[model samples]
Target: MTATTSDSTNAYSTPADDGASTASTASPAPVSPWPRRLACTLVVLVWPLIWVGGLVTTYDAGMSVPDWPGTYGYNLFLYPLSTWLLGPFDLFIEHGHRLLGAIVGFVAIGFLIAAWRGDQRRWVTVLAAGVLLAVIGQGVLGGMRVTMSARVLAMVHGCTGPLFFALCVVAACVTGRRWQRDRVLAAANHTQQGQITANPSTGLPADALRSPWMLWPTLLFGVAYLQILLGAQLRHALPTSSPSMFAHTAMTHVATGIFLWLLTWVAWSVMRGCGDLTLSRPAAALVCLVAVQLLLGMGTWIVNYGYPSILESLPGSASYRLASKNLLDAWIVTGHVATGSLILAVSTLLAVRLRRRRWVLTQLPH
Candidate 1:
């Protein structure tokens, strides 16, 4: 009987030992990277819509239909197939923007679902939901702008695009393993016995957070966003011919562009000095985008000037105007807008990376 009791105890203990061994050997389930990649991909995909929307705005096509949620008495989708198929191009651009808006709405919904299901991080899921809500609200605001024909609403609607872009940026950061790794590294570094002191001149924390690497990029992003807002207001003022419109706004846009150019230079300097490849790569990208934006701005001005309205020409006059009024100009305008959105995205990413480094510096066990 004692032998039997010993055997049973040994059997129970063996299972217990096996359970412990299995627990140790079984690694935590690998976190899928798909959600993060999807979030980033979605952000990029939405840029075309941003560009298209900007074109629609610049052309003052907001009220082409003079109706909300419909394009001339039919639901947006059910609008007469004949009209949709053979509509004025203006109708097409305006309706196309609406359709892209709907697509973004659905994409945002999918992102929310993926984040909620696949991400271990709760904030990521919450942020995805928030973005979905923002897209929905923005859609409504768009409809309202069409209904009211209010310039103020239009401005608000335009401004919301960048904010939405920023939110997606945050979502991307939260979902990425690199961001988490940086956070962990920073924490570990900061908690070390000897905390690094910030450089007195630059006010950067000695550890990872205050790296001049982070500060300059964050500043560049802020300036870019302000520039975009200024540009939007200038475009908005064009149709109204408001005396309150300052030619200086255009000049301000130019100045901001210059500032952005210089900021890129500064970022490059910082990157070179710091020798951080991560920071340098993104800074280089920012510089390239800025260069492209400058060219686009100049091209837009040239196009506006060189192509006087052919319709304004006397009959039989040579119509030297290229296809300047069609989808191509719209696309150029959209690209300009999208570049601004990209700037905002990259800037926010740098800021988060810096923040994680800082968090580690501050919280890691010293």
Candidate 2:
């Protein structure tokens, strides 16, 4: 008999909205684990070793020891301290490399411990442990080179340093704070876009299959890695009696570097067109680095050709001239190595960010 009006507000409310709100509020805050920070610190700390190793390699100091596992039959740490203080320049360079290598070994141990005990991501911790073991193997390879005094072994030992640096870069990426923050933010964004849906076939979300911004970074990373490999080969190549080897390798290196810059530029353009400011910033940074590299390359050439006077000085009296030469060489080598490391860092960040973004977009409830 009496008309009853249904509650309009309750009738119109959806369960999805309530669920999203509750999930958002109930999600745990991200923990700042010690392993993550330790991993990052290890990466930062390893750069010095990379630089020192480069110096040793460029100066042909790999044979400074002429012995493996120990220096002149004494433990690496206990080897005559006075030799380093009074020995030839090669001894200084070689022993310095050993010291840096030992330091890296210790840091690696700490990194492994932190990864095992402090990291939340089990796979990442496992990977870090693997990297630590790889570094130890690398040390053994260095010792073998000393014992054998084989040029080929020396080349392999030299090549492994960059590979080890790259491993550390990976470790840094896995435990990075920026990566974790991006993952959280991306997940949140996906939820807001309603793009999150689990696929019935693969059990992965449809959004995971999308994201046009990632191809650019991946392409650039490939180019950079290939360029480094080529450069390493060139470094180990025998010196030719004819200048053609220098000309050819130098030209090829320069050309490849130019191609790398162009590829990076294209990647940046793609990022910009896609409205991906996150990637665009690193792209711009890479562009600047390449530009610096070009200048340094040209500077080395000019100093090499235009300054014959410096080369004429006597060995002992030419300290100033030698200093200038060393300075230029150091710049060129350091710039090359640093740029390579930066490329690795930026590419890794982009890869991780894009992955997180994909994950977030896929989780949205469209």
Candidate 3:
């Protein structure tokens, strides 16, 4: 009887056995460097592509090369460096934008391969595939726009850029080390929704953050995206656009900009008061960037349209074009464009973090 009892207890698992079982089952996952690195590479490459596209628009150089999938009848990749480098400035920017876009596509392929090999999540693989498809579609649409002389297609292609940028950024956030670490922390704590209702430290009410993360950030992202599209319409429209249409878009851009600013500020306020640096810091950066973007909007107006027409009411003053958009104009406009993408990306990152964190909090093993 004594021997049977000892055998039964031993069969159940000694402390050491329990420790071994826990170690085997709960060992922290090895962080995959390639996936995160590839995602980051895509993010870096895509943003510059945005700037290059802006430059193409800035110089009215979209048709400088006058060829589709090629530069001046030469295969795009085979185009001579000497010709491109010494070419007229407009051709340089336009062709360079094409070349940069190709590079982004290639990097996207790399990211897809890396994610397939390293990210075990099936959804991640699907997302990478979607990104690849978007890149290919972007390339085709750009080529078609140039070949068909379709300005409307160009507007569509322009709008997709920011969305692609946001997608890449969100993927990077999900593949990041910190994101994985948070998952582990949540799993280790096995946090249940109703249990302990407060955050780890300070006993602060974490419920205060629920809506901020769950709903507000996402709403702000959509608003920013709409503003981007409106900005793109105004950009692609330019002097050739109907004056009334231009004025309406311009007014809409400013009005939406103010609305987006308020949304971001409110999000930041909620996050800052929530006492989570992970959420609060990004919220803070977002507000600052949005502020800078508003300022840049002003600069964009001054550079392109000159001082407001209202200023013409002054004594002996009249409305006039400002210096015909010099190189400074190009840089300021491109900076504004690039910053808008960055803001969009950052907003995406915030939304991903908040949504994931909320999921972690609510779905903790009960």
Expressed as tens digits, the lDDT of each residue in 154-255 for candidate 1 is 888887888788778877776765554333343333222444444344554445434444577678878988988987776666475655555678778988
Q: Please estimate how well model 3 matches the true structure, expressed as its whole-model Cα lDDT.
A: 0.75
Order of candidate numbers by TM-score, starting with the best: 3, 1, 2
lDDT of 1 at 85: 59
- Residue-wise lDDT of candidate 2 within 292-354, one digit each (tens)? 766665554544444335544645434433344475676576566556656655665666556
**Pairs in steric clash, model 2:** 194-364, 194-365, 194-366, 195-364, 196-363, 196-364, 196-365
Index of the highest-lDDT prediction: 3
TM-score of each: 0.76, 0.74, 0.84
Please report the candidate that would top TM-score against the real structure.
3
As a whole number from 0 to 100, the lDDT of residue 2 in candidate 1 is 17
lDDT, candidate 2, equals 0.61
Off by over 4 Å in 2: 1-32, 80-82, 181-209, 239-248, 272-278, 300-325
Candidate lDDT (C-alpha), each: 0.68, 0.61, 0.75
Worst 10-residue lDDT window, candidate 2: 1-10
**TM-score (C-alpha) between model 3 and the true structure:** 0.84
